[model samples]
Target: MAMTLSTPPVPADWTRHTPFSDPGRHAELLEDVAPSPEAIGPVVRNLLAHYRAEGVNMPVSSRDDINLRWVEEMLSVDQERHPGRSLQDPRATEARLQGCCRDHTLLSVSILRGQGIPARSRVGFADYFVPGWHSDHVVAELHDGERWRRFDPEVAPESGLLPDPWDLEVGPGAPFTTAAEAYRALRAGELDAASYGVAPDHELSGDAFVLTEVFWELAHRYGDELLLWDGWGAIPAPEEEMSEDLLALLDEVAEQLIAADAGDKDAEQALHALYVRDDRLHPGERVLRFSPLGDGPVAVDLRRGEDAVTRPGIP
Candidate 1:
């Protein structure tokens, strides 16, 4: 029962809607990539089965806590097997049932659909820290009478509203280009609470998204050449080590933020805290150090400002 409808794509309108503003609207302006209704269904059933096998129950209502518990458990299971690939995209699907954030969303959508409820996938920058250089999030929308309901599989109702994906409170505002840009701005103090907006009761694990990004950078840059172990190879580091990179990236981003203001003193000072003095601003756990160019006993701290921190292997 999937039909392509023509409508202006408005992804960030956080308020839920039913039957869509336009019944024929299919291509959401916010959706860079969309899944076929058919594609979405199987993904959901697979997730349900996967979790059900592990003894998880579906949410009876829009209980954030229950949903979040499911999300955490799902991620934990996936992390145990595929630690490096935990995102909210279907592209990261490893098995019929297992997937990243996107996959989870798709699964949620399917569950809603199975109940004869029309649901759609919403993709956007989520401020909550998971693991990566950027924030990407997925959630399901259900049309319940007049207004649609916003449901987050990743957010636990009990945990409350996770941090706004960009720390911007939930409301209508000018849309930003990418989540990374939004995050960089927030980090640099460019976007104030008033500008970016906010979300209610949102929670995040800073290490998850930050570390994922760092590990990805390392893998791309040094893994193939095996520079870390004298050509031995680059194995994906742990979560804490990966988050350490967030500090490094944040430092650079902070400088960029200052530069955006034409060398504003405040921005420059902020950058100084991160770049100069090599203070371990956010020192991550110290892991077995390895040289990027060659074999050497170098301490690697994924945390920002750690002297051991080096440039990421990839952009």
Candidate 2:
């Protein structure tokens, strides 16, 4: 009932890009890069800098609002920031695109796929960032022929969080815990919900945040790869009250995710079936984006490129 899974073989779809990870016109930027994390991690680090960490002191105007959800948009911003610089070159902290863990994972995935490698992003809580605090995070996983390997492109060698940040071992005692694993742990009274969330000091730490993250993990697994703040369907708003029924549904979801991740063929099929049938599990055409930059909640049309409709009073 821990909802943990062993590493499984890579899916063919993961070798390709989803709408969020696709580099579009800038796909050329990722070309010629080696598929291994050793080669790709540095490129990702150079192209984008963490808004809160490396670029924290950046001007208010430049920070926060620039969490480019799409890799194409991120690449566009990078080009505008530093023209003619190759992806391998070091970008000035100011020139790097401002984003969080998800951006790092997505860009890394895009680059890997471009090099014909099977890669995907994982949404979970990383306990390595702060002692006793599990912050919501995203990491990339690539299939190196035999099995899947998880890595944190956002973590640099200087951080000293892991022996090698490019390759990470996840699960029980490991630094990272998938949302499904955390959910199962919470239900079993093995873990405290309050300890898992956005940050140690942020107000968004609780059971509800963990529940939303279960859906976040599923979405990423199924190729949606949405931004950390994007919410749709069954994903609850911070103010919304959760009913007993919704919690039950999430319990079932966590179970399926765990089994599927372990390469249970039947569980994989069932999980996909559940995602397709449940609007609560997968996003629709539009989603409510809760911007961390204080832009307020707005309805984003997935079909419309970068056009966010300001729907007043949509909590």
Candidate 3:
């Protein structure tokens, strides 16, 4: 007999706040700017007109360009004003007008959660823009009572940036691959790891990037919001060095991520517990900031509370 599976219940506050998704940090950064996740995209669309994306249109003049870890860091202007500001709230980020895809995604997650919506960030590869390649990317997802809906705040129609804005009304036809899907594809050999990251010239590919994202996505669902480079398990190792055992582990990790993406509370708890003891993976009340710049990514530090460690005394 075919049995029916039930979806578990997730708390409304599960995705609410971490130092990573603190919307109050937005208002704390700019009193005039309401830290509304709903309003963040419009603000980003407007802000990008002036603030160039670091490493893309703009050059990394200082670590500030790369070190802006949290969503709020995008708000501050100039290195002299806020150097090494680890996390920038939306208001502050808007003020500065600089950020990468991760910053845009974090801001959206923060704003949405502050509005009392269950939202979280997803790390994966996007195939929507450059047909042949899956670019390393991040996006936001919210539970609309019945099912989880994906939202690419960076590609919102208001920005007119992405060639194809994912239509929430129509459901998930977007260009990005969730960490779970990437893991599955790689494991099945349906997709090669070399084609996984940005362009062929980019460094990532093989199992390392896809598996790292799966691990990252698992942590994000359980509210850890780990930094991009907080490697454990198989993260820092080269793909050629990965073993069969590691591949099997990645398969399990992918399952958990897929479950979390589908809003499985049981899987969420399982992943949380799995990473609970890994000091590097489980920041608990702390957040590790990852800055993807230069040949190797930089690690900021572990921070506690919602306040930006990089910019204290602002509030």
Candidate 4:
């Protein structure tokens, strides 16, 4: 008989989290998150048709020209959607026409990377014409002839100034203190995945500090599901159990990191505090209120609670 949910076997390779380590195996596993390019052909065609109809010339010579033309030709100035509402897939680029600003830009990065172009993912807050409230953003950068040129997969003409990675201001403070500080800043709402020019594409855990790179891969697959957790294992869950398997998976990751001495002393200490001890973990039956912002992404503010620890103070 076919395997059913009642007798579900834990997947074999949650332990391995590498990017396309085995292209064949990865392709098989990613069937759920990424669509095949062939299936997306129609979408790409439509995007290209739209651009052509508008008389916007798409260029593909040097990376810079290609990036510039992509920005200028593909995207419109009408800002209707927030960045987070739209869904993304690795294979969306396979569509002949490309997608809206974000879709096309992500595809552009994938295509350039496929062609062996040296590229890097950028993520952080975006402040274009909009102001004050920071929005999460992602993009790609390529080394054109002499210098590196920034590219946005989301914009048509691809015109926007990406602040220096260290220069980004999330809310009250500079979100990241170091290059890898993004891992922490994300939870505090100080830094966003897009600010790094790469979509985070996953929710993550605090214990993830140990196998940082590996965690990034896993989180990417389930961008919205992973939570910022401290410990691992099938312990008594503080919140409604989303998936016991996921909890167990995190436990396994924590064990691996602790064994490997993955993160810094603070991270190690935090992990221990969260799992081995229960005091650091939030107690059950406490309501944490977040104020719904009328304008930007939901700004979180602590209304009142005895269990509330540190309010994610957004300055």
lDDT of 3 by residue, 36-145 (tens): 43445665544442223333444345335434555545454432354544323223433344555666677666655555556677788777546677777777776665
By the lDDT metric, which is better: model 1 or model 4?
A: 1
| Per-residue lDDT of model 4, residues 220-307, tens digit only | 2211111122122222332334355544455454443333233244543444334333422222222222111112222232222342
Model 2 misplaced stretches (Cα beyond 4 Å): 1-12, 304-315
The global C-alpha lDDT for each of the candidates, from Candidate 1 onward, is 0.34, 0.77, 0.56, 0.30
The list of candidate 3 runs beyond 4 A from truth reads 1-8, 23-25, 28-38, 48-63, 76-96, 156-174, 230-234, 277-292, 295-299, 305-315
TM-scores of all predicted structures: 0.27, 0.90, 0.72, 0.28
Clashing pairs in 2: none
Q: Whole-model lDDT for model 3 versus the true structure?
A: 0.56
lDDT, model 4? 0.30
Please give the ranking of all candidate structures by lDDT, highest first, separated by commas: 2, 3, 1, 4
Scored by TM-score, the top model is: 2
Q: In model 4, where do residues sit more than 4 Å from their true spots? A: 1-102, 120-123, 143-150, 156-180, 186-315
The candidate that wins on lDDT is 2
Displacement of residue 93 (Cα, Å) in model 2 is: 0.8
